[model samples]
Target: MYCRNCGNEVSEKAIMCVACGTPPLAGNRYCPNCKAETSPDAGICIRCGVGLINTSNHSEFDWLTTLLLCLFLGTFGIHRFYTKSIGIGIVQLLTLGGCGLWTLIDFIMIVVGNFRDGNGKVVVNKQRA
Candidate 1:
């Protein structure tokens, strides 16, 4: 993978670019897959056609409902179910949310607005329609 901000080569599991101090996939200035320059508003890499996934994008799930479910029934993976993550929800249920560790991590992620839904879109705080 490459840093989208600086086009610098980075490890696949890298959290941020060592050279630019930016999250690997957090920028649209370059393609993380191909290291090619890209427009900020471009959806995909014109060269490699790789989709530039952005965390700022919204999901269909509502933030308030998801937070409420996780707070109330997180151990049961109710939040996962509400987010349409059926497979992980089952796993979470069977494992009691990884013996609570997974649930705790998920709670933190959700509270920080960093949790992604089943479709990979960030579950952001937004007003209901």
Candidate 2:
């Protein structure tokens, strides 16, 4: 493997690049698989055909806020609205949260930290992360 920042060869499991003093995959100047130079915003490494997604990062939505909203105003789909799930929020609002069954299920999902935002990102507490 190679450091994406400096193109310095690195152990596959290494955390940071010794040559550049940065996370091995944190930069976009080079490809980690083939050491080929890459455009900053390129999603794939051209030479190696490898994806460039940073696997170390997982962006999660707030769990507490979603949980509380679901507990208190789920019947009105307030939690859904807060998560930017506008279409589902409107449906829930019109249907009164599926006559409360949907609200109950959503509350349970939130309590179990299994809820997702409109963007499909998982909702989890920062401490848990």
Candidate 3:
């Protein structure tokens, strides 16, 4: 592997670059796979032809689908299904009307990315702002 901060060779599993005292993969100045210089905005390393990982700090959420489901079928746990909360959705449906308040609260939380899927992974919304 290579140190992204200084383009120096480093251990593949190294968490920090000893030469530059920086996290190995914390920068976009070089390719981790080939140690070749790369453009800051480049997605693939030209020398190794390997895709670079973009570690952007952003949570993935499905806004449109969640909003629609919450507005249209929130009473029946459709939004829960859309968000992959099948057990909660089924319980909401089976309870007849016990989950209405819970589902409404879930709608708000989903819009804000507080609600996650069953795997506890945030849903990645691909819509551009």
Maximum-lDDT candidate: 1
lDDT of 2 by residue, 1-129 (tens): 999889999999889899999989877788898899998768898888999865223224578888888888999999999998889999999999999999999888877767778877567666764
Candidate 2 weakest ten by summed lDDT? 53-62
Evaluation by TM-score, superior candidate among 2 and 3: 2
- Candidate 3, superposed: residue stretches over 4 Å from native: 1-61, 96-99, 124-129
Candidate with maximal TM-score: 2
| Candidate order by decreasing TM-score | 2, 1, 3
- Candidate 1, 93-115: lDDT as tens digits: 99998999999999899888889
How well does candidate 3 match the true structure in TM-score terms? 0.47
Relative to the true structure, candidate 1 has a C-alpha RMSD (angstroms) of 11.9
Model 1 TM-score on a 0 to 1 scale: 0.56
Cα lDDT computed for each candidate against the true fold: 0.85, 0.82, 0.71
Q: Give Cα distance to truth, residue 48, candidate 3, Å.
A: 23
